[model samples]
Target: MSKELRINSNKFIDQTTRLSFKFNGEKLYGYKGDTLASALLANNIHLVGRSFKYHRPRGIMTCGSEEPNAIVQIGNDPSLTDPNVRATEIELYEGLEAFSQNCWPNVKFDIGGINNLLSPLLPAGFYYKTFMWPASFWEKYEFFIRHSAGLGKSPTKPDPDIYDHKYYHCDVLVVGGGISGIMAAKLSAENNNETLLLDDKNILGGATIYQNNDCFQIDSTHTNYWLEKEIKNIKNIKNLTIKTRTSLAAYHGYNYLLAKENLTDHLSPDERKGKIRQRLWKIRAKKVIIATGSIERPLIFNNNDRPGIMLSSAIKKFIDFYGVKAGKEITLFTNNDSAYETAISLKKSGVNIVSIIDIRDKSSSKIVKEVEKHNIKIYWKHTIVNTEGYRRISFIEIMQLSDDGSGVIGKKIKLKTDCLGISGGWTPMVHLFTQSGGKLKFRSDDNVFFTRQE
Candidate 1:
């Protein structure tokens, strides 16, 4: 109920149009353009779900489809209910009903939470080892196990929503709507080619729209300002068609692909009546440009899966685009320079940044200096060994990295924190390429799997 965490800023959200929704029976309010995850974060509700095996508390970890947690059941009616919907992808709508999955009774105080205390007894293959005796009795063991380990429940009744399919042919098809994809579409259309561009978000500019910092510039203009101008230019091209909220689901040989366009998911229940819920598009293009962007990989550490622990890039998006702060006090842990931008953004937004723990020993990057100039502390050659707090992160135990960078050394230092944003690096979006029979090559320096060129 209280929009205490919501900041008064001219971001993506329309402050005048307020939408009310319910999560686990509690009514909450958000703005017109806020996603379900951003709305929840604006209300300071982070513990959204529970893990499958241990039943540990989980939270919204990302701002997009790469989210590993924060999946919930949407809608109240049995036939209209959809399960395992990513909160990051769901748009906030009036009367939207959402409930966390996998936990018995409720997410906060779940009975299945006992499994966390019994974790030592349940290893990775605990089921295979414990259920092995008497192969004939395996059926009995499976019945109980099946009831315990899983995500949201599927609707027993038939789905009432309508879905249809279509076919299209284009001279050039761009799989992403990021800065690169938009430029590619513009260039192709200028050459008298029919260009079609697709993106998963409701907006076309992609991540470029959120780059509001002064560190990046294009021809003496801020990157975000320049990108907005470019997007307007692309919109004026007659031969170019841009489709937002359209996801490419499958890619086959000979430049053939399948995409799904969301039609009414962002609308209110009353407005969505009699409208198509989704449409499948079968595309045949002469040339396809795979401009899908990269995904930020989360750092691996002890108790890293706890609630309130999120990706650094996601934190930036929530702050810069949605005008929401993840926490009053935040600690960022990163291996590279990307997170420094997030630190600067949050600092400028009046967030109390506890410190930035960089695994690298030293950095003279301009962004790093900018963060330092803002009086934000930076811990170089340090890594988090463990974290504290049950439902949400309260503090973290950090230590100096070993000389060879294989382990941690020295005594642990504890710092109070409400949120931890970690950035391990990025993995290129190569799913479409691999699905189309393209081979991949792993880049050791960046620890990314890239498409192998002929």
Candidate 2:
């Protein structure tokens, strides 16, 4: 067990910063300036959820949108609960109740473990195979399937809280707060363009704040500081509004974007103070640069739904940004160059990395060379075939894959570990580009789809 810590409420907020919250129906306390994820971490409660299929244990994986775990059912009523919400991203207020999703009875103990014993009988798209067998019994079997599917639960009652949408005008809009986002914002501010940078996280420093993570090879904090200095130096372009606790939900023609602001939920349920809980900001920009970044794709395999398995990017946020250790031992499975940064970062953080299983044949890339220097063992043309763990990942079975990636056809390798980090590749969030009617094409080099000329 880890040590538990609490806020010295009296020092941070006036009128005694006491707020009530609940997790799994057990009431807890929170204070002002606490996001649901942070508050939960403060309590030393690591397991907040379970895996999708195998009912394995899950903890918060990231602090921001990149989170793959820590998603929970918030609020008491059906309408109030936001399913699949990143706990680290939500601000906590008094009376904020949450519960683990994808778990039966409780997150710690689940009947789903039985799936592991019968895993060999399951594979990717197993549901498609099982539902057809009896044909006549499909209807009866569907009930059990539905109950075991999906993350989070629906509230039985209506939501008591209110949520609403605002329109503003800006000369420039930056969609991310990472290095690129900050650089764009700084440049816009310098050019005297009324600039606004929007990010869903509570802090303006995006991935840079987690400098200890392996992905952060450069000095992210220094870059952030330079951006801050640049913002301060400009007198004319200084009219910039950086929305940290805001997300750009949509983009429209003429460069219009919609943003949402969470106002009161982080303080306490009763501390509304008659202020609007949320507001929508519609902004028109002459130019928009989306540093919106990318999301990790999970590898397809049998029993991949085991708990404790998540995107590698998520691990960085949990350990570096949240100051919370996700697991004692972690195994990273990747088919790309990016996940190597995660393995390196975890090793540097004193977290034991069981091994790195890479599916690539060979790489002349600089990152691959670095992996060799670090002495991190790499598996070529291999992928995870199955996993075993309950409420958390305990071990993984990897097998060599056919060159065409249609199937696995080599000897199996197994490693003992607690967490499994996977990344098939990345999916650039090109919603805005597509919403603007932009076309996307496959990029052979990146092995991803990117916006291309029509």
Candidate 3:
């Protein structure tokens, strides 16, 4: 395949080493450090899967574990098959086989897609209401429902991979390896404490690593430069143990938790002969810091489940870190100021910024000014009413919000765009805290849920 969507500049990807993989039986090539999602975007293949209920076309929405779409079945071998794997989280490897699920016959032409037209008849409790009358025939109804409900197919044979468990005791345990987590681990280790830090990605510095613009500075140095220096300093700390590709799976009482460490999943089958596939880490820490960052929430619009509609942060990550552009012309719709950062990043990477539609009435922020200075149009108090295109987004219809902010007021204006990035502010990641018996309170200011301080 042609590298049409890939940027020419050298960034995080090692272009010297090329790896070939199969997606729905089509052979594709990607660089060494590219994820399956980034590789797919680089080749302009965004229709990755079908939705669960309506069978609507879905693409890669986010670049991490918070991804709601782009789940696929991995491996052709039954014994090695893994289903419901997030394409964004999987690292690219040679001979990797990925197939779209939840679609009958094929993903491109699925018969199950009739559910989209019949979605109006199928309400939230349609299954329970329709199947409850016939008591004796319930088993027959369940069999048909169960077969069509799930997304991917499970392995018929047992998994043929080795897995082990280990235990560790540390004075300080940091769940997220983002900039905040790294700083906490550094300070703990400097005080001679046994510090342990974990991150789901293979690299450190988190989102800060992708932020290369000079607008952000810390102590007169660029944010990326400062983060790089801090990461280098933390690596020299003796008491700190950094674990990459390790995700915190569960949090128990008394500061106990479980983390899953990926070992050989990123390697080729031939290279993973005797290596363990995964290891479970049972950790006990005296003190814990949950620094897991927030996830970008998408805007609610008509036909929003269509392919090529992704989160704003995911777009920035793909362009800044992976050197891949989702589209040549992009339109961003946001309700807050955070998405302006994505606009700047995309513009700097040579991607066309068609326009930015902000739901608020007006804004005088520096980022907004910067975006307008580049001649990018900003439509304030406007919201998308409809979207066009089937397998991928081709255009969107937007209108100005009413004075009461309850509905659209003006005529719909259509804009042609290949990609749409939406941001509805962020909801703090408090799942681990809530799992450990913590209470949460909703903040009305930003419409986010946060843990209540003790």
TM-score for each predicted model, relative to the true structure: 0.97, 0.75, 0.97
lDDT for each residue of candidate 1 in 128-179, tens digit (9 for 90 to 100): 8889999899899989988986688778789778898999999999999888
Candidate 2 weakest ten by summed lDDT: 6-15
lDDT tens per residue, model 2, 1-454:
1322332222223224556688888777655555677566556566787667655567765556657777888765555667877887777666787888887777777777567567788788888976898888988998988877777666677655666766778888888887678778878877888888888766565655444433234445444345445434432355677887787788788887788887765655556756677878878888888887777787877767655666787775555444444566778888887777776666655677778888888777765677677777788788888887645567888888898878899688888987777888888888888887788998998778899986
lDDT of 3 by residue, 1-454 (tens): 4576777776689988999999999999999999999999998989999988888889999999999899999987878889999999999999999999999888999898999899999999999899997799999898999889876777888887999999999999999988899899999999999999999999998888777766788888878778989998999999999999999999999999999999999999999998899999999999999999898888998889889899999999999899899888999999998889999989887899889999999988888888888899999999999999989999999999998899999698999999999999998899999999999998898899999987
What would the TM-score be for candidate 2 when compared with the true structure? 0.75
- Model 1 residue runs over 4 Å out of place are 1-4, 132-143
CA lDDT, every model vs. true structure = 0.91, 0.70, 0.91
lDDT score of model 2? 0.70
Error of 3 at 375 (Å): 0.6
Clashes of each: 0, 13, 0
